[model samples]
Target: MPFLTDPVLTAGAFAAVPQPEIPTGDGLLLRPWQASDAPAVYAAFQDPLMHRWQLRAADSAHEVRGWIEEWRGEWATARSVQWAVVDAGEGALLGRVALHHIDLVDGVGEIGYWTVPAARGEGVAARGTSALARWALDEAGFGRLELTHALGNGASCRVAAKCGFALEGTKRSAVLYTDGRQDVHLHARVRGD
Candidate 1:
């Protein structure tokens, strides 16, 4: 009999926890959030492209530190798992990827991510997103993954499509951007056996 067949074990909520590090394509590295990443994350957030494409507004140093603490807590407490993308060759952080909403009972999760400006057009986002989703579905037992983007963010749409996400639909005025309400496209990647 499988451990998954144990009633008591199955009754508890499965968590999207992270080990200190997991391997990327060429590096033996994939780690959860850390306070040290605050600076890099803040710098990445300052990019005009992310601000316009994402709903997040400008964050202060304090906010970035606080965000780091929050993310660390999630990883420590088994709520969510967030990874800082890093250079496989140099071992330097390049971006971030997260299993945002995890519902173990339902076997569903959501993936959100952004790459540093330098990493864009290098397939970093697509590769990182793909690796994270594979981990969730294959190792973490998630049955579904969802991603969304503002309709105007064509790059993100392309990445999602590349990762095998099927466009569910577009909802007008669904996402409230910092500037105003914007249209959103929902994409999903169903698990496969």
Candidate 2:
């Protein structure tokens, strides 16, 4: 397939991104979200910290299920691929990770993740994030991956660094939260980096 010398950025024909079960080292696995996990997802999202950084809000199990369905829709449209990070040993949902803002033509995407309260301080986010990054860059053929976090989020910054994302800089008032606009730090990793 070839594009004209100057082509407009259209949605263009896109194949669905694969969503296979990925095994993360140390007994962790990344898999597609299931409707049965709605209650757990809702519980995780109830955390104040999660609400502070992430814009998603699901007050009930029904809403959480809808959000999971939305994730599947996004995946089918080639817009995003989200995975549920689980503990293989316990079969417990530990977190969620996603490769979104997918630009197939440009070979780029952005990563986002959050760990449940019980999974925090256990390296769940870092491990799951790194695993997804490898898959996105190598298997998915993405050339570059970007991760941005609120400047006040130290844990996210540390996770990004651990996953080999270099801190590019801060974007002033880049994110508008419910309270007010907040600055965000941009971190990036290239395919060969």
Candidate 3:
């Protein structure tokens, strides 16, 4: 009862995805974003660096709260998994890492991250990214994950490298920044790699 071109596939339901708390190196915790963390999220997005790369900007804590709620929806739909990077002792929101563009059937996803200005230069992005990417590939049953950054963003390039993601190639004018279009470097890691 199947078409000749149809490939046999495993069944998956996005609504059944579970969110787990992940611990990272150097006393950092990766967990679901809380309503209370909206203020910190808003503050981090205000950074100049974030503005230069990311397209959306939150103007207030309320908007960030909405963003967090949307992330919860994404989790429920198996569309994406987002984690709030926080300090172990203080529970201070340090950054965020996410596996977006998730395809449950294909077992593939894309990784993205941003660190607060205060947490920059401390390997926070690298550590959190590694933890999240590993979790996606190992525990989450993903076969491949990709991370991309603007070619001019050296810091993000370093983070990807530190997490063992190999440079695949350049995507010409793939990203549109506020200023103009920019070439992006595509980095990826397969489950075994």
At residue 43, candidate 1 shows an lDDT of 86
Question: What lDDT does model 3 reach?
Answer: 0.87
The C-alpha RMSD in Å for every predicted model, in order, reads 4.2, 2.9, 2.2
Cα displacement (angstroms), candidate 3, residue 160, comes to 0.5
Compose the digit string of candidate 2's lDDT tens values, residues 10-84.
253334335678888778999988888899999988999988988878879998899888886676677788999
| Stronger candidate by TM-score (2 vs 3) | 3
Going through the candidates in the order shown, the clash numbers are 0, 0, 0
Question: Least accurate stretch of 10 residues (summed lDDT) in model 2?
Answer: 7-16
Write the residue-wise lDDT of candidate 1 on 1-193 in tens digits. 5555323113233343335555666552557777778788888889998888766744776688898788777764444668888876776778888887666557777889888888889888788888888887777677789998888889999999999999999988987887899988999998782
The TM-score ranking, best first, is: 3, 2, 1
Top-TM-score structure, candidate number: 3
Q: TM-scores, in order shown?
A: 0.85, 0.91, 0.92
Q: Is candidate 1 or candidate 3 better by TM-score?
A: 3
